[model samples]
Target: MALQIGAISQKGGVGKSSIARLIAREYAVAGWDVKIADLDIAQATSTNWKQRREQNGIQPEIAVEPFRTVTQALKHASVYDLVVFDGKPHSNRETLEIAQACNLVVLPTGLSLDDLMPSVLLAHELVEAKIDKAKIVFALCRVGDRDNEIDEAREYVRKAGYQILAGSIPEKTAYRRASDVGKAMTEISFLSLRQRAEEVAQSVIDRLSKEG
Candidate 1:
């Protein structure tokens, strides 16, 4: 069976789809057959991004498909080495469902309490629903370049009693431009930006390794 990973969020614009594409690209580059289950039916962000990627003739050829339910997406698990579930923008009943189904549930958020509070709340909700807390992880996204702010945010998540990934997706126009052209975060033109994004991707990979 394929290892299922979920990129979930409490709201939009928090880099949920970005993380999903990042994981898909990373595994595909490593020669693993990967597919992104774009569960955001209303936006279809990842599905459209895949179209743009094909237009640009990107390598490795990551696959993406839209599905209305997590159950529907899981049916394709046997076809790929990995299945990334890109959940919708807001928290709902499906949030718990995704958390329950995925081997790892990643919640991406910004560095502010407005983002962190709700993310932590969502994690708590999953735990209350009898989901394993160990399976839930946090990733910082759209973060500013302030070391103090980043450290504080990390501390906040730790205080909330959950593990946060090592690397973060910084707020940069270059990243947005790369995504606009159907490129993953690690595909940015700027070497520094690409490396930083790779670090975030590697952190996810390492977390999955430990899960085994």
Candidate 2:
């Protein structure tokens, strides 16, 4: 079975879909079978993204599906190399299921007070659900130059006692444009912020591949 990494969150508009797409592309480019299960029932971002990719003829890549629940996402746990779930807002039940089904669960958030607060509750819920601390992580996304902002958010999450992934991708126009066109950050030309996003993807894979 391939390693399954879930890009999850308790809030919406926090870049869960974008992170899921890029991570799926990273594994696909590496010749690994990667599947992205969009667990956001209301938005279905990945479902729409898959349609766009097919319409644009994106080839030899991953199989992105719109999965509504944990059972839907885990049906192929023993089949795919990695199944990254983009969980819905407010600690969706699917989040708990995938946490149990995969080796890792990645929670992506921004560095703002509004975008940074709810994660505390979400982390607690995951912990109470019996998600192993070793298999769970927090990834700070849309990290701007606000050093104080970043540091503050980090401090809060750390105080919550959860592991944070090392890389933090800054907000950039290229990422927005790529998502609009259903393309991965690495696939975007003149990616002014490609390194940040790429580093994030790689760091996730490395962390999940490590020896606990």
Candidate 3:
């Protein structure tokens, strides 16, 4: 059975691509075949990264196939254990469509108020589309480990009566460079980020497993 996951957000530049690739890496490391739908054709961040990873021939065994169409991508999701969709960051009709297709849809957000507000709105859209609220998880991205920003963001989400995933991704230069090189955090040298990423990945796995 395939596990389809989509990483989407209403606002851009909140590390949506990073989370998509990270979960792909984690699944691949666990010996599961994974692919990315990669709907953000304009940025093509995940597609470009996929090409680079294929070129470099990294370990942990993964495959990525980029698709521009939602129907085609949804069809492809039937094949792999995991199909991660990196969605366009904004209010997009396709984002709603993607949410409806996957078993679990993750919305990656930062600690800022601006990032939080739109993400909540997108979550609302997902729920209104009749997507199960349990299928949606909030991924806190680019947060400092010790900084108050992460807790603040979590508190805000909680106060708004939304449940967020227990994991948070730290702001790291290594993560940035890894994405630039078309690699996931686990593929990079920084063991700490990789560990954190594993925890994040586990949280995501828990959510998907619970749904299943």
The better candidate by lDDT, 1 or 2, is 1
Residue 78, model 3, lDDT: 67
Model 1, range 69-129, lDDT digits (tens) per residue?
Answer: 8889988779999999999976578888889889999999999999999999999989999
Compared with the true structure, the alpha-carbon lDDT of candidate 3 equals 0.82
Q: Rank the candidates by lDDT, best first.
A: 1, 3, 2
Clash statistics: count for each candidate = 0, 1, 0
CA lDDT of each prediction against the hidden true structure:
0.92, 0.79, 0.82
TM-score of each: 0.98, 0.91, 0.93
Candidate 3, 1-212: lDDT as tens digits: 57788899878889888889988888888888888888888878888887877777777656666677778887867678788888886647888888888888888888888889988888887788898887788889888766677888988887766678787888889888887777897777878778888788889887777766
lDDT of 2: 0.79
Q: Select the stronger candidate by lDDT from 1 and 3.
A: 1
lDDT of 2 by residue, 133-211 (tens): 8777788888888788788888888888888877687887878887777788777776557777788888887886675
Span of ten consecutive residues with least summed lDDT in model 2: 59-68
Give the distance in Å from residue 199's predicted Cα in candidate 2 to where it truly belongs.
1.2
In candidate 3, which residue ranges exceed 4 Å CA deviation?
none
Best by lDDT: 1
Clashing pairs in 2: 2-81
Superposed Cα deviation of residue 63, candidate 3 (Å)? 2.1
